[model samples]
Target: MTNAPSSLTSAEPVTLSEDEAAQLAEELKQQLRQGQRLAGDTQAIERMVAGLGDKRGLLRLTFAESLGTVGSAAVPALCQAMCDHDNVTVRRAAAKTLTLISDKQALPHLLKALLNDDDPVVQGSAVGAMAVIGADAVDGLLNIIVDPNNTPMQTGLASWGLAFVGARAPQALRDAAKSENALIRTAAIAALGDQIQNQGDEEARQLLLGALKDPDEEVRSEATTLMGKLNDSGWAMPLLIPNLQDSSPLVRKNAALALMKLDDPSAIPELESCMSSEQDASLIPIFRLAINQLGQER
Candidate 1:
């Protein structure tokens, strides 16, 4: 066996005293105040993350808050904490920080936290973080809504995330419409129709229309709301119309509203036919509001 160089002797472990941690923290705070300069920020980030494992969660929380704003300098250390840390509060901080840093590599961890974390606040933060990272997270985000364990918070956050991912995430939203969970399915279709606004993307638009036929009444109503927003979307019309004279009053009203947006007199017939069918007479105002503009320019 080859012998190691004698000059490469094992270095003794250096321990930081109370004063040392306080000093490091102050220095890092100074660096953080500098803002947008990662070149000289490495030493400070190293010091910050090194203390993240401190018994008091405040230290980790402080580190997280600081590192999150530091951007690139904090990326490497926060990446480590996202997976390796044990503290939940610290983990929450890591998640929020990732939102500020918002890189693609953090997606897996963010998704993991969104789906699996016990804390609702943390899950909420993870979803928001996905939005900060933008369109790149569409693939994983679409899958998140379909999971059976979705809580109300998760559903809401997933909807928020999908609302931002746009048409690129349509496949997941379409598949999500088939979920057994009412909340998940409703949220999925709502996001596809209202958020993604795939009105111009024919494939996605068709999928949204297909979702309008879902068994759930709320899902159908939500889908109708989307059709209203798609007036400028240029979506292809389907052979079967959903929410037309449907059982749900909300569905019927929204469908009339959607047709009015199309500016095709053909929809006026449906709107006119819906007069008695619109369960909520209050929405009659919508029909009255929309009728004259049916064929008028948007």
Candidate 2:
């Protein structure tokens, strides 16, 4: 196997002209496609990881993709570069490459970068990698979601990862939904809704309906919003009608919006009754809109 170019190991950010980067990327791709083994070549792996910093966006992406083709063999080096590399570009690219690799062994490094990285792009890429790792990443992501010390952005990223995991491994979400922490419960419920969206999981839909009465308003609100998005008029409309009188205005508003999406036309009398007694003036417009839209549907 040909050695990686010496320039790829430079500590300084690697700046390559577009054509040069393209040629290097093509060479690496050809080598890997030929079944050349990179598994035992630590120096070559690190050098290739460094090449992820190349200035050309497409070439950087190509290098990342090439590293991904190296599979689990490249993960450790990529994780190290993601966490320790001074170049934000390298860090971002390393985390992004890990996404394509989707190795569970990369989860801790990805989680660390997601929680501790200074660059938003690096953090985003790390969370995305964790998402691609799927089921194995769920517990780590749920821990972040429930950690009071995590910033909203950090928790938000973890929640996104959980949603991704839920879509692929909903059993993990079902387990998470039983957590004692309300935050975990809320995130799990939301993720379950996302799973239902993709697969129309009837069990997940039922779980979401149960959440409407959760002691926590945020859980209710999330379930309410998802019920509207489910577009399951026959199944969701009846359960959502009761939420129109929910104590939380957000839940009430969400219920209205969901009923509107259901477009049952039969909801007119219930919506009209809600509008007549609704104390929150802000809900008037929402109720009117739902009524008007449902009227047109008739």
Ten-residue stretch with the least lDDT total in model 2 = 1-10
Q: What is the C-alpha RMSD of each candidate to the true structure, in Å?
A: 9.7, 5.9
> What are the lDDT figures for the candidates, one per model?
0.63, 0.82
- Write down the RMSD of candidate 1 (Cα, Å): 9.7
In terms of TM-score, which candidate is strongest?
2
Instruction: Give the per-residue lDDT digits (tens) of candidate 2, residues 1-298.
Output: 1111121233543355656667877788777778765443675566577678788786787678778777888887887788877889889889989999999988778878877788888988989889888888898888888878888898898888788776777888987776777888889998886678778777876778679899888889888888877777887888899999999999999999989988899999999999999999999999999999999999
lDDT of 1 by residue, 1-298 (tens): 1111121113221234556766766665676677534332656665666565455555556566677666666765555554445566556666777887778877776776776667777787888788777667765665666655666677668778877655545566566666777656677666665444434455556656766777778877777777766655345223224466688777776776677666666556655666646667777887766666775643
Candidate 1 segments whose C-alpha is farther than 4 A from its true place: 1-22, 32-46, 50-76, 79-87, 167-189, 192-220, 228-242, 247-250, 253-298
TM-score, prediction 1: 0.57
Candidate 2 Cα lDDT to native:
0.82
